[model samples]
Structure formats: C-alpha cells, structure tokens
Target: MLYKLWRSFIKEIFLLKRDIGGIVIIFVMPLLLIITITLIQDSTFRNLEGAKIPIIFIDNDHSEVSQNIKKELEGSKTFRLLTNFNEKTAQDAVFSGEYQMAIVIPENLTKDLNANVDSKVQTIVSSFGLEADSAQAQKKAPKAKELHLYFDPATNAGFKSSVMNSVNKMVFEIENKKIYKAFQEQLGTTEDIEENKNLISFKEITPLKGEKEIIPNSVQHNVPAWTLFAIFFIVVPLSINLVKEKSQGTSVRARISPTPYFVHILGKTFTYLIICIIQFLLMVAVGVFLFPYFNLPAFDVSGNMLSLIVVTLFAGLAAIGFGILLGTLAETQEQSAPFGATSVVVLAAIGGIWVPVFLMPEFMQHIAGFSPMNWGLNAYYDIILRHSSISQVSKELFLLFLFYIAMVAISIFYERKQNAV
Candidate 1:
C-alpha cells in the first residue's frame, strides 16, 4: 500500500513538473500579487503619514486673539496655513481645488469674548463646487458673525474629521482661557488658575497581550493572505487532474490492481500538501528578503517559530482536504475546473483574505468565522502580528485540524458510495 501511494505521488509530481502554466500559476502569480499589493499599500500609508492638511485662513477679526489663533495654526505641523487671502479669494481658491478647507475669524471676536457673550467664527468650504450655480446666482448673501466652514465634498471623511477635531480643540482652549481670565479678574487671584492648569490628561493603552509594538504594515498582511489564497487555488489543478484520471478510467484500472482507493487519494493529497508548503515558504521568503531590498517593511516573526510551523502544517492539510472534496464531487474537467476556481475566490473573499474581517459587517464577520481561510488568517496573525506562543494558537490549530478531517471524511464517503454503486 505504501509503495503504491509513493508511486502515485511520484507520478503526480512528474505530471505537474511538465505543465509550465500550472507551475507558474501556483508559484509566480502569488509572488507578483503580494509584491504589487504590498507596494501600493505601503505608498498609500507613506503619503498619508507625510500629508499636511491645507487650509486658507482669513483672519478678518485681526485682533490679539485672532492673531494668536493664526499663529497657533501656523505652528501646527498638521495644517498648511494659507494666510495671504480674504474671504472671497479664499472661497474661490477652495472652489478651484486650491485648498481642502477654509476658516474665517469673525470681526469683534475679541470684544464678544471679553464681554462674555457667545462668539462665532466663519468657515467656508469648497463643497467641491456641487452648488456652484446656486451660490453664484445669489445676488446678496446675509453676512453673519458665525463660524463658517467650507469643505470639498470629495475629501476623505476621516481627514475632514481629523482637521475638525484639531480646530475644535484649539477653539476650546481659546474659550477656556478667556473664561479663566474673566474668573481671575472677578476673583483677583491667578494662583487658583495656575493650580488647576492640568485638569484633564490622556494616556494610550494596547489591547494585545504582548509588549506594544508598531502595527505591521501591508507586506505583513498581503504576504500571508495571498499565500493562503494561492494555496487554496491548488484545488483547480487537483480537481482537473482527478477528473481527467476518472474520465480516462485510471481509477478503475487502479481499483482492479492491488492498490487501494484510499492510497490514491492520500497520494494526491500529499503531493498538493508539499506544493502548498513550498508556496508558503517562498512567499514568506519574499517578505523577509525581497521586500527589505526595495525599502518596504520586512516580515519579522517575533513569535515561536515552532508555533508558526505547526499552524502552517495544519493550514496546508485543510487546503488539501478541500481540494480532495472538490475532486471527488467533480464529474468532468470542465465542471470541476470552474467550480474549484470560483469556490476558492469566493472563500478568499468571505474569509478575510481579500479584506480584513473587522471591516466586514457584523453578520458577515460572524459568517467569516466559519470559513477555513478565516482560521488560517487568524493563525498567521497570532504568530506574526500578536507574537503569540504555541499555547495561544491551540484553538486555531484544533479547528483547522477538525476542518481538514471533515473535508477528508466527506470526500471518502462520496468515493465509497460511488464505488458501491
């Protein structure tokens, strides 16, 4: 039985080696995807980190308070201050896509603040020129001393929120200082104000178990995700080969001989398992070695190496088991090829291979938990991102093994029923 399985495995390996396209699809395509996606993501993150939010500042108030606010904005690295313009010019610049936002400090801001009256500033945003006709047609617009904010409708929501938060913080500080000064004037004491200067503070906390580290970049994510995607793709070729053998009466020929049906299945599974492991190692090698050469982040594994190996082995088994099931169910090469290819794509989509599971809706997230790709991704993340120990990934390992077992059992049951008939 062992000799028969070995021979069958060797035959599959030889057959695969002769097929150039299959080899390229299994090996080269995944590396290309990982590199391409990682580079794009890295560039985007770098741009975001270095980007400065541009804002046009029109300080019509021109008072001590307004000047101070202008100086503060200019000093902030988060904002690029464009101060050489009035309200109309600033509004036009924003409309022409020259800036993302605009701010106007209303006249009598200092007087209103000093008198303890509610004060407002005017902010004008471009609105991406959506209502340009209506805005231009208005012959006379009422002048109000209120904070008028104008924003480009096409601007990213997160970027807009960040700019708003920073501006609001500055406004809060300015108002709080005015109130504090008023209190000092009424009470005739600066000692109380100085004593309560630090009434609020903030601290950051990490939810992971290990020492907090910088979050892994796109290379880390793409390498593992595309690696698993490539592994699952092995089903297509495996199914096609199995369908060809059945159509050619190879299975019948083997059954008439001394070789058992289980040996044939085991042989094919082992061959693909070897291929999966090789594909995974190659992808990881690209991350660790090739990525750093191009100045991208390297794949640094801080967790137990043994744990990574264990998880990877089970992941391979699960993928191979799935391929075997596809092979057993497929009647013809044409039927099996599309089913195998499309099923892997669907699995990758729902399993968080293409997108992070957290980004999915709550219901989709719940469904993703049932996907083998989800288990594989979680296992990889545990080892690579979380730096977890062997014990930490025991549950993922167990679930992966259970999935592999279930797939193999289903495949065998179907094969036996066909044989009995």
Candidate 2:
C-alpha cells in the first residue's frame, strides 16, 4: 500500500500527461515576476534620489541659538531650507510641492535651548502615509499639525551615514580644548598637561574598532522582505496550472487511479514547492553574495537550515491548498487565475510582505496580523532579523502551524464538495 501510494504520488507529479505551455506558465512565469518586481522597486527608489524635498524654517526668536538651529538645517543634506516667511506663505509652500517639511522655532527657542529645557520642536511634517497629491492639496488648506520628516525613511539609513558625514564636517569648527577639558574634568585629571601629551590626546580621538555597527536601518530590511513577496506571487500561476488540469480532464483521470486523492495533490504541490525553495535560495544567494549593501545577514546554515526549509515548505503547502481550493471551485482557469492571483497580491501588500508593518499605519498593522504572509514574515523576522532560537519562535511557529491545518481542512472540504458535483 505504501509503495503504491508513493508511485501514485510520483505519477501525479510527472503528469504522465503533456502540456509544454502549462509547465512554462507554472515554473517560468514566477521567476520572471520575481525579477521584474525587484527591478521596478529598485528603479523607483533610485529615481527618488533626484527628488527635491523642500523645507521651510521659521525662526520666531532672532537669537544666536535660533540662528544655530537654522544653520543645522542649512547643513543637512535631506532638506533644502527656504527663506523665512509668514506662517501662511510657509504653509502654502508645502502645498505647492516647494517644501515637504516645515520647522518653526518659537519665540522662546533660544531661551529654552540655553536653559537646557526639554522643549518640543514644532515640526510640521506631511501627513502619515497619505498620497502625495492629497498631501499637496491638503497642505493648501489647514490640516492638523503633524510632525513629518523631510528625510525619507524609505531612503535614509536612519540618518546614520549622513550624520557621520555631518559630524566630520562639524568637528573642524568645534573647540578641541572644550572637549579635552570636559574629558579631563570627568576623569578627575590634573588641570595642567604637557604640550606633547595634549597633542597626542587630540590625535587619539579617532573611531574605535567595530564602531561602524552603531547605526542601522537601511535597504537590508526592505530587500529580503520584498524578494519573498515576489516569490509569494508564485501561488497565482501554480493555482492556474491546477485549474487547467481540472478543465482538461487530467485531474479526474488521476483521481480514479489507485492513489488517494491527497497523495495526487501532494505531487503537483511538491513540484511548485520545490520551485519556491529554488527561488528563495536564488534570492538569498544574490543578497548575501552579490550585493553587500543590500544584503541580509548570513543565515544559519547549521541545523537551522533544515528547520528553516521545513518552515518555508509548510508555508508553500498552505499556499498550495489555497490554490487548489480556488481552482476546484471555479469553472475555468480564466476565472480562477485572477481570483487566486488578485487575492494573494492584495494580501501580500497588507501583510508587510513588501514593507515592514511597523512602518505602515496602525490600522494596516492590525489588518496584516490576519494574513498568513504576516505569520511567514514574522517567522522569517524572528529567525533572520532578531536572530532568534527555535524556541523563541514558538508563537509564530504555532500560528503558522495552525494556519497550515486550517488550509488543509478547507482544501479537504472543497475537494469533497467538488467531487459531489
């Protein structure tokens, strides 16, 4: 019985039936999609480099502290500071796309800074995750004052590199004696030091070993997440393939064989599941070996690789079950293809498959929690981003395991319903 089931599973996979174009659609198309979408996102982000994000600075206090703050804006690479103008005109510029951010230093700014008070910086940023055109129009009218940043979160490396460069430039202007004296006071050192010793101490302020790891937030977060998203689109074409088999009378013929219905489905699923694994490895290879700047941290290749592979395979199985359920319900591939594909695509967007959910709106984050992609991503996040132990991912693992069970149940019910007809 075991040998028969195994042979039947193998037969279902080879299809023993021929459709050259169907194989191409199932296997080849997903590869193209992964490549195309990755390229498009890369190009779009690169294009944003040329965008001129304007910034208006309002200095209500005409003091040196206010002037120094203005100088800070002048020194920043993210903002092109506009001249001081009335509140109405400054606000109007944000609407006109002449500025994307506005900073207003209140009349008490100098006093606050001098007194070392923790005063709030009144920053007028564009609304949260709104469309640019809408933001532009709303800026013309009075919108709630929300603090938006001119530095693009999508582009900036958490302002780390830029900040380091700015520090290098600013250091030339700083009084070296002030820092040394402060250090001496903190260390309880003698007030007088030899001239040669002072010179040597000045040169010793270079960066310490491994200090470069201090700041993060770069393309690393986006690249792996988005690459997996493109791979997830594979469910669409694979679902269409299954639907085609049904319409063509192939599935019925296979079902009547000695094989159990589940075994037959498993074979076709395994083929595409293997496809996903290959694509995942390809993306990982490109990320770690090809692009250092965009690379994800090296994955654990020890015992963890096998567990990771199993986790990823279960995710593919869930997708396959969803595909089959959709395929069996629809009368034709034309109807089923769009239904499955559109649903996955939309779910991917909501599930933080493209961008981190933390970066999205609170509502969207809540919505993403309902998606299987979110569980898969969270699993990946635990392993890759947080460097979690297997035990540490218990919550994500349990949720995904439950999702797999639910999908299998649904697939079984859908299959029985289809067979009844």
lDDT of 1 by residue, 288-397 (tens): 88999888988876545567667778888888888888878899877888888899999999999988889889999999999888888898887777777778888888
The prediction achieving the highest TM-score against the true structure is 1
- Cα TM-score of candidate 2: 0.63
Query: How badly does each model clash, as a count of residue pairs?
Result: 8, 1
Candidate 2 local lDDT, 274-389, one digit each (tens): 76687666655554564444332332333356556655775666666666667667778788767876888787888887676899889998999988778777776666545567
> Which pairs in model 1 have colliding backbones?
121-146, 121-147, 122-148, 123-148, 123-149, 124-150, 125-150, 125-151
Error of 2 at 276 (Å): 2.2
TM-score per candidate, chains pooled: 0.82, 0.63
TM-score of 1: 0.82
